[model samples]
Target: MEKRRLGRTDIDVTSVCLGTMTWGEQNTEDEAHTQLDYAMDRGINFIDAAEMYPVPGRAETQGRTETYIGNWIEARKNRDQYILATKVVGRSEMTWTRDSENLTRQTPAQIDEAVEKSLKRLKTDYIDLYQLHWPDRPINGFGFHSYEDYATDDMVAFEDILGALNRHVEKGNIRHIGLSNESSWATMKFLQVAETNGWPRMVSNQCVYSLVARRFDYERAEIAMREKVGLLAYSPLAMGMLTGKYDSGPTPKGSRKDLFPTFLGRYDLAKAAIGDCNETAKKLDLTPTQFALKFVESRQFVTSNIIGATTMDQLAENIDAHEIDWTEEMEKEAHRIHQSYRSPVA
Candidate 1:
């Protein structure tokens, strides 16, 4: 596994990161710990989670993912072995995450509350990397091709958000700060504000980046290379579209598509392109999983490719994809797919 520097920080995370969004929802506590153990044995040292995880978030299963991870940390008693990363819900209706607040905004009090709660759940004094799950702004970040108008004035100030996170850093609640599902302009703005205040910089941008989803390549990729806020590519498999599991026919039983099809509605926007990508993978003599995962790992701006799984076999295959050599022919095929599709999902 290749190690890359996380932003300008001293941390060097593996090119492959273990994602835990499906841990509590699709899998059990033992399964989450099993995946964590296998990932560490495979030389992967980065773990990504969120406050609103087990995807399809609800009040019942909220924060269960972190609780499971905290259990693993307690059992292993080796918190220093790997770097743990988690996020706070940003500007949403996940009010259950807070003590008494109705809305989950990135305000100072909310951030403070979120940090303390995450620390308590994660069973750690300090988080290695803390991220805002999404921007506090009122924009449709969930893949609206053309920007729909939103009230820009009705949002928390960037300075306030950064200041809140900086306070957590100062208090030893988190080591670094990051962003997710953010726009190019917002990323630059946060970086600039952090520089001005001499606060902790945004180390990485966790966004959708796969063979079928390449919106990050348009502008944020440059920000990643130049500013060091590199891309922590999530959904790098297009939610299993790139793996060819949904290529032929009906959704596999008990799979993500079978369990929660609406969660994959974003990929439905680029169905034809996704099909072509899977076809391209076969033409290159690579499994679609290897093709998709390696493509994201090959990007210059990608700090780490976040891979998730519900079973050991899928987890092993995802990690094995990192070992394959990304060839020029593969890159050319990926480019051809991009030219035809042109990021329809975004």
Candidate 2:
């Protein structure tokens, strides 16, 4: 696995980051541990989790994902081997994350509480890369393409959020900070604030970027290249749509689509484009999973491609995808797919 510097930080994370969003929901603690062991053996040095994880986030299963990672860290005592990253929830109604707050925001109190709880749950003194899960502004994130015309006069200032994260950095609770599900404008704003205030800068922007979803390529790619805050791309397989599992048959049992189809609704609008991408992969004599994963990995602005799985087979295949040498032919085919679809799922 190739290593890249996270932003301008000294931490060098593997190009393939192991994502742990499905651990407590579709997988057990033992399974999560096994995945961690396998990922480490495969030279994946980066692991990403969030306080509000195990998607389709229920109040009952909210922090179980971090707890599973914490248990693995405790049992293995190998915290120094990999770069650990987790997130603080942005503005949302999933109030179960905090003790008394009904709405999650990037307030100093909420950021303090969230980081303390994540450190306790992760069983670590410091996180390598702590991330803001999303902005605390009124914007339609998480696969919604159209901008919601709404007032954001009451949104928390970016300076305040960065100030809170700065305190954590100063205290050694977090080594660096990043962003997720953010826009180009927001990224610039955060960068400006951090630079002007001499605070910690964002190291990466973790967002959805797959063969079917190219929203990051439009404006953020340039920002990533110039600013050094490269992309830690999540959902590189478009929530499993780019894997060809649903191309010609019914949704497989125990799959994400079968368990919670609504979460992957963005892919529904790109069905034709996804099928075409799968066919293009076959035409190139490659599996759709390999094709999709490699395309994301090959991008110049991608610092790491976050891959997640619920089963051992899926985990093995996703990790093995790093071995595929992305050729000119594959790039041409991917370009053709992009020209046709033009970010259908964005």
Model 1: per-residue Cα lDDT over 97-121, one tens digit each = 8779878889989988888888888
For model 1, what is the C-alpha lDDT against the true structure? Answer: 0.91
The residue pairs that clash in candidate 2, if any, are none
Please list the C-alpha lDDT of all candidates, in the order they appear: 0.91, 0.92
Give stretches of model 1 more than 4 Å off: none
Specify the highest-lDDT model's number.
Answer: 2
- Deviation in angstroms for 163 in model 2? 0.3
Expressed as tens digits, the lDDT of each residue in 1-346 for candidate 2 is: 8999899988899999999999899999999999999999999999999999889789999999999999899999988899999999999999999999978999999999999999999998999999999889978787776777767687898888999999999999999999999999999999999999999999899998999889899999999999998999999888898888888677899999999988888787898999998888899888999999999999999999999999999999998888989999999888988898799986
How many pairs in model 1 have backbone atoms within 3 A of each other, for residues 3 or more apart or on separate chains, i.e. clashes?
A: 0
